[model samples]
Target: MDDSSPPEPTGDGHYERLSLPGSEFSPLDALVALVRERGLFVLVAGGVVLLGTAYALAAPSRYTATSTVVREAQSEPEGIPSTLPSIPGLNIDPGNAGRTGLAPSAYPNLLTSREVRLAVARDTFYFPETGRRTTFVKHVNQSPGAVELLIDYTVRLPWTLMEGLGRLFRDADRRLGASGARSPLLAPSEEEQRALDALEKKVSASTQGTGALGGESGLMVVSTTAADPTLAARLNASFIEHLRRRVREIRTQNTMEHLKFVRQRLAEAGRELERAEDSLAQFLERNRSVIAGGGAPTLSFRRDRLQRQVRFKEQLYGQLQKKLTQTRLRLQRQQPVITVAEQPTPPPEPSAPNRSLIIVLSVLLGGAAGAAAVYFRSVLASAEAQESGREKLEEIRGSLTAEEIVQGVREELGRT
Candidate 1:
């Protein structure tokens, strides 16, 4: 046998041979032994199952509710402009309209804005059963006499030692150039920054998804979430209503203003036209005999001038009539140009607290923890066995050496 190689088993079962260096035990045998030795693995797995069951039972049940609002495009009028002259090779369709001012994607952010939040916050209750009220902050000032007493009791003072050190440092700073040095601090104005601080706590809004819903013509859905579902729904409805009102009001105001200017211009044109007709009539009356004497030049000139004046007045009047009709349509509240395809409904459930997902995660986590415990326990048991075997090997080596020493001394005595 080679000394470098490990000793092979003699089949008499004195010792077992290792396939590799330093491996005296089979993994399969170790596992079997571990299974026989440790009842803790079963206990740990049972504990894990128990904990998982407890978590599933103890956790709060979560419910989700969603409400959708479909944004619709503004309706267009049915007919082409009467003034647009028909010509060859010209293809004009009234249905080919420009995009509406409002967009579905834009509404989501507006639902969560401070403007919407403040509006909802001002209202006390959407429905009486919810029993929720809006809360506002109020600041009160202390009376002059109580101010000093309140300050003395409430204000924290510096330690005496620290105060003394601070005084020394302050005196040194005052004596040096530090006293007159400029500070680098810059701050926004109170009024300008006041709204910014309240923005986050005030409003919450989000968009749901992309594309139109249900293959509906010109319909886009937007959804908003809030602490209060009723308020969220109300705010969303209000935002859409507000947007429509604003668009209409703005358009109406602009159109009315333009119409007023146009009407004034028309009035001025009418007056000018009347005066031109009167002057032409007088000229014709004065030149009636001259034109009747076959002077075609004078007759043609007067007719042409009068025709031009009539045409101009007619065109101005026509434009004003068209503008007036449009303005009237815009001002009418009954006919909303941008109609709400779907009204906002109070959500039936909160759109959060996904319970099923949480329970699944808990089970997975418990299994992983149980597996880690089993591995750690096995490793610790193997380390302990290795330490115990090393100590026994040291003791055996010491005893064998002592016996050899005794035999060597006995042999020397016999030789003597």
Candidate 2:
């Protein structure tokens, strides 16, 4: 009959509930409970934080050096636009000018390409931890550092296992590849190509605008990272140098080959011109009397022919020499497909092992772990309390999802 008292159980159906005063829920009380039982949470959190600290300490520092490259950009040459057809109606095409287009967008790929990479490797020496006669490819893949070694092994373990499993599905593929089947889509690359693949992982490239008008606004950025700062800088520079050289070769290859041919002809012409001069001299000496008598038309004709031959040879040689000079200039001018805006310098400090960032992240991670543990324990405690209350206490009706809220309500009521 009284509102505060427990109702008697009905004999026909329902289970009887024990009356409980001040047994309710709220967030503040749940928080108090968590604080009271924070030991496990603290331990878990501390362990996580400790692990993060250890990882930070064990992680090796990495130095990053960047090389800024500016694309040469496109512009009309000094003379006529040879690329543009002289016909009455046709669009201009720079690629038709017999020079490879120096496109900025393609620089990233060219810089990291196997050809440029291998060329760089061939020219450069290995950087001894301090900073190589060996191929740059071999030099770049030197063994990992202690920390790096640990990480590589640890990280690669699962991948290694997965690779083995993957191979099971590709047995037929392996056989086909081994048999050298000519599939256009899936041809195998050379070992050097695979080496370039690895080298590419260490190198990165990007582009920016130079604020210039027209199609030449692209500024390329190429960067590389390594354990040693000097090595990073040197490798980046080497890659750029080789990339430039490669681009120049590609653009001027035809002209250079033609120039070589011209030079050979020029050499032959020089010999012919010398021989003609000597023969003409001998003929003039032998025909001295005939020339004075003005009766030797054949001798005169012979002398005239030799003089013409000498002049023709000299003219040919001059033209070839001029052509060779022009081609050399063209090659020199086209060599700056990608100019170094800024060379890589040995970084003063390591880029990785970011200590402050590690510390902050570690604390956040630890705090999250602690919070999760607290929440889990809080839920478990609530479940147990609910079970016990079901057995020995009366249920209160406030809200269907008000179990925790009721518990907090009880705590405040008891305190008052």
Candidate 3:
């Protein structure tokens, strides 16, 4: 027997004797032995593979629908607002006001907003096999109420208890640490709160990925997966319509406010002009009796001064009036910043369940799981072998060690 070989169990089991072969077992040889001798292991692995294949076949198909939205950066006409004060004069080229363009970053929040979600939920329809028209929310709610009830009960009771248990487990850190004292968990910070809020919005929006469909053209892509393709198309179209309506309403409100301001200024200027004319008339009427000796020069100078004043006031009033008109026109037109670049069409093919991809993924996952099961079984078998050997050693040696014998005697005496 070679000294380097593992021991073989003796029949009495008091001590084992080792027997070594002339050549040592290589890694490749041991692996081959494990595979050949462990027929159960291979059978278990084959069973796992078969089970995984069954699961993949039994799994329901899932579909993904995608939509795209493009950002339209509408440039406000230049010089309209800048020439506001000089509307009556052509000398000054009034430039356009610096209007703030909507940022793309804002679109994620906008698309995921509660208002948009609710609008989609309300407008989207689902056609059942029965050919009945059902809104999206209604369809979701139509599922067996028992499932919802069970979920509610679980959330209301065990969920809260589990959270408390989690806190207790986490508190174990204090016992292991030097401080021994535990700090209370604090509420989330403002930034954390904002992040949570954004997360909630994103979840509600259900937007799948970073891909957006539309570019600069006010076109939006709205897509939804439903049992009926026609219903899905209609839902997308309705969502777009609602979005447009909301945008129009916002634009109209802004335009109206601007128009109101312009009209107010126009009214004030008109009142001031009237007051100036009334004052000039009153002054001339009172001074009608007082004629100068050099009537031509005095009258010409007075007339020139009054005419210049009136002309200046008239120009100011005219500019204000023009601004008021333009504002009103803009309010009426209410041009939308976003235009529909592409209208949704009924999709001929379902966007979801890419069968080829699903099958490929299923096979890969099944293979990986099968491999893992094989490895875990090998480890468990090794552990069992070590445990069995230790038990056999204990059983063969009935005599206790000094400390164990003393403790056993003491325990027996105490019981007596």
Candidate 4:
């Protein structure tokens, strides 16, 4: 074979190899590769491990309370259930939503709605970091839970740097806001808005369906997170109460509206009937002789007309009264669709800030750093060795004969 060509493997698994490139680096090889930077690598990797440990220690624990609910059909509701249009992301399956109509799917979203959340805030008390308990609607901010605390730790320095830069841009607009120039864009007042935002984040409503929104069954979950376990449980319970009340409102709103309109019509019909009867009575009193005279032309025509109007009004009144009764029955027969499947209980343990996993990941991170360092050094060494070998080959070629080069190759192959 030519000197530049690769040799084929011999039958005994030996070959006259001409070149070797360091294609693979095993774990042990990685360790031995970066001998010169071992101290630096140790320091950096150890620092990463220490940082992770500190983060695990510093992160606060948070409790989660959960309430379960199920979607159910009303007992033989007449007409269509009011499909109060759901918020965009609330019901995942828009196409399948109309199968039973909007009412069933809307129950889940009713829990997370702005109205329900606002009402919950008004009911609850807010305890700030350094103050006494005040009405949540006045000024409310609950510190973020464990997950947020962990994220804070992870991105603390970088976030601080970014925050400073952001301030440079937003400082003027903030001053304008502080001065009472109401920003046209924001709907809620600052205090109310903050409370809503906090409550929104703390509350989570999830359903058991594989639909676009996921969680489809009658099964649903309502959860709340707070620093105090009891508070979390209480919030969840309160939210559920609001949800039930809202469900009742939605269920009866249509019927009640129809009932109100029917009652108005019934009253109007009664008044018209009374007026018609009174007019007929007065006309008879003025012309009592005409009916007794039985063929007074003017009296007969006037009396017949008045009698017919009175009869029509009476019939209309009866119809409206019947409609009123039916509407009331429709409202009364419909019971609460959403029932409490499971009540919220105080969670005994914090669900977040997985200390064990955090530590394990920290160690793995350190190991990864060490591996990277080793690979970096190995590449540099390989480049330097290649350059040195190239220089040596040039020197050898200039000084040695072809026979020497061939003999040296044979010897090297034999030794291998």
Candidate 5:
């Protein structure tokens, strides 16, 4: 063998290291080879670990603020039962009888709804990191840091290029010109939509319970993640506020509609009562002597009928008045949809970029990479001694080249 070539195994167990004619080298032999080349493995692994640490330090920190809430059911009147007296045009069927606005499972969906997201987006917030007051959309679209920009140009180049090209082809005149006067009924602007999308990912709601056979324990958690701890807490609070407001609106819709109906009916009953009273008053005025004394049967019968009609109208008017009062009371009794069980607070530590784990994984990957690289280099060096193997190595290098592939793509796009 040439002095530059690797020596064949020649230890007492070298015979065991040799494989059968048709088989590959044993795993034990590979392990022995890696052990012999520990220097290269350590160098690569250490470099990879150092890179991981750098990445962890440079990456944006994410702080998650969480708020725990309990779903509060709407309370019934003190003396009221599950069912109420049926009315002619009013539906007394209890709307959301046991719970508040919607099921606990539906809260996640409600928190992500367009209405809630838009409201939160338009609201002004104070960001301590920037020491500026800005809307959610502006805060979300703030310029990135140097590391973020570098990542966007490197690892995220494909996605970044796509976004850039999309913007280039977009109708800027239509979007920015006076012709962009969007109707009040139109969807949100592009920036608002992007902010809303970010909100969808950053803000989240989840329901948790003991999983009892009975029912849900009515516990929910709302969380918001951001680069700034205080901002995360503030965003969580905003999400909770909007979520509660939405729930209140949904829960009270039925009661409000019923209140309107009651008011209208009460007015009609009052009018009816007035007409009946007037008719009874006129009849008694005309037949005062006949009613007081024993008069004709027909006249007495007419008098009795008029008095009964007046009484009936009076009863109906009183009932409606009572209903109106009760409905108003119920509206007042409507409790808040959610009660804050645990207030949101800024987290001290970051929730992401586990540097230790990243470093550990990087070390392992680099070691494997280095071992495979060393093994392949030795095999190729040995193979180069044969003409056939040398030709195959050249073929592999030519196939791996990227210049031709890039040129072909450019040509294709030019033709298009």
Candidate 6:
């Protein structure tokens, strides 16, 4: 029962573990064990650290550029006060009282939408790597570096094999009279799609300080990442520009159509008014003496009818003129104005691949891995010293297979 005595071996092919109090545990023994296997520990730890350092140096640098914008917030109009007496002819449009323009909350989604991305993809940018200005599509489809090519081929190996097999089967089926379906008309070409995908991954948007109690704050930040700092800044700026254009178009689309309609009607009304005036003038001139003489009741009646028609046309034209003015005002009000709070500038330093942090984490991880390996080796050696433990260990080694090891690795990666 002495504190330094080892625990007795149990019948279950394991040593008995005593439930010692916290004060009885000593860290010095663990330190001594690690020092005893210093050679193995240094080999594992040093190798891991070297690999991490190499990765830190070899990884590509990424720069993130950001632009901030503040959108004008529209609030609902107040209803008529109870103290004010309602007028019989005065009317208020309920639709006009509420916000009809683009909402601030939708800025992030709009920036990330397919339309904006496609528009950005069509823009030309300067790529430092190629030392030439080219469209985004061409840049995305450019030749890959040796390392990139290797990674791309390795990652896509399974998919490539599957696709080949699929084509073979499909050809056989075609010979058996199974026809393939037609491709969709709206699908994009492979090059264009690659550019769009690249934009989707690199460009992003977020909102900040959205009002108290879940209200919209109207502040937005758009960001883009690229290998080159200037390119990153350019991409960020392009996203903001296209996003503004799209927002304005969507906000004023209905109002612009309405304005066009109103103008057409106003023009028609003016023509109708002019025709009525001409008919009245001609009728008066043709029967000037007769009208002055008041001799023919029929002629006087015709003059009166023509005069009334002219007055009616004048009134219609006036109403349409007022409607045209009101529509112009509404269109102006519905237009969205995005104010740029902060312009994107070329980043002075890379925003990714923090080498120092990577090195620190690598060191910690390597040391921990080394410690675990040392402890496991010691325990394993002790277990092999006994007859029952040797037999049990042999059984375990015999039971393990390559397939199970691969499955276990896959499961661990999935969890990670």
RMSD of each: 17.8, 14.3, 11.8, 14.3, 6.3, 9.6
Please rank every candidate by lDDT, starting with the best: 6, 5, 4, 2, 3, 1
Q: TM per model?
A: 0.47, 0.59, 0.59, 0.61, 0.72, 0.66
What is candidate 1's CA lDDT for residue 127? 31
The per-residue C-alpha lDDT of model 3 at residue 96 equals 38
The residue-by-residue lDDT of candidate 4 on 200-277, one tens digit each, is 888888777655435433678899988778778988888888887777776677556666776787787788889999
Please list the C-alpha lDDT of all candidates, in the order they appear: 0.50, 0.66, 0.52, 0.69, 0.74, 0.75
Sliding window of 10 residues with minimal summed lDDT for model 3 = 199-208
User: In angstroms, how far off is 96's CA in candidate 2?
Assistant: 2.6
Candidate 1 off by > 4 Å: 1-73, 76-123, 126-132, 135-289, 296-299, 337-350, 369-416
Residue-level lDDT of model 5, residues 47-92, one tens digit each, is 7777777776677788999999886555676875545455444333
Q: Decide which is better by lDDT, 1 or 2.
A: 2
Model 3 bad stretches (over 4 Å): 1-100, 103-109, 129-131, 143-223, 291-309, 334-342, 354-363, 380-416
Candidate 1 C-alpha error for residue 13, in Å: 25
Stretches > 4 Å off in candidate 4: 1-28, 34-37, 70-102, 125-132, 137-154, 157-186, 208-217, 251-256, 271-312, 325-338, 381-416
| Tens digit per residue, CA lDDT, model 1, 86-191 | 3222232212212234454555555554454443333343432234343211101112246444544544234434645765665566456443544322222222
With a 3 Å backbone cut-off (N, CA, C), the pairs that clash in candidate 4 are 92-213, 207-215, 208-215, 208-216, 209-214, 209-215, 209-216
lDDT of 6 by residue, 1-416 (tens): 76566556678755432222235545764575577678779988988898789878878899999988886664422332212232222243323422245677888998998788888888999999889999998988888888777755775578657756765665566456534653322344557666776789898887786565135656788889999999999999999999888887775676676677767877877888899999999998899997798799999989899998888778777766665666666555543467788999999999999999889988998999898877777667656767877899997886588876777788889952
Per-residue lDDT tens digits for candidate 3, residues 1-416, read: 64554545578753231111226635554454345435544555556555555545543343223455554654445444434554553332334322233443344456555565565655545465545676555554454467446654663468656745655654564344535443322333223333333324223223223435334333344455454566555655655566656656656676666666666767766777787777667656765655333355675577567667667677878876776666565555545554444555566775545655656665566555554554554444444457664576565465467766777798889952
Model 6 collision count: 0
Query: Which run of 10 residues does model 1 get worst, by summed lDDT?
Result: 135-144
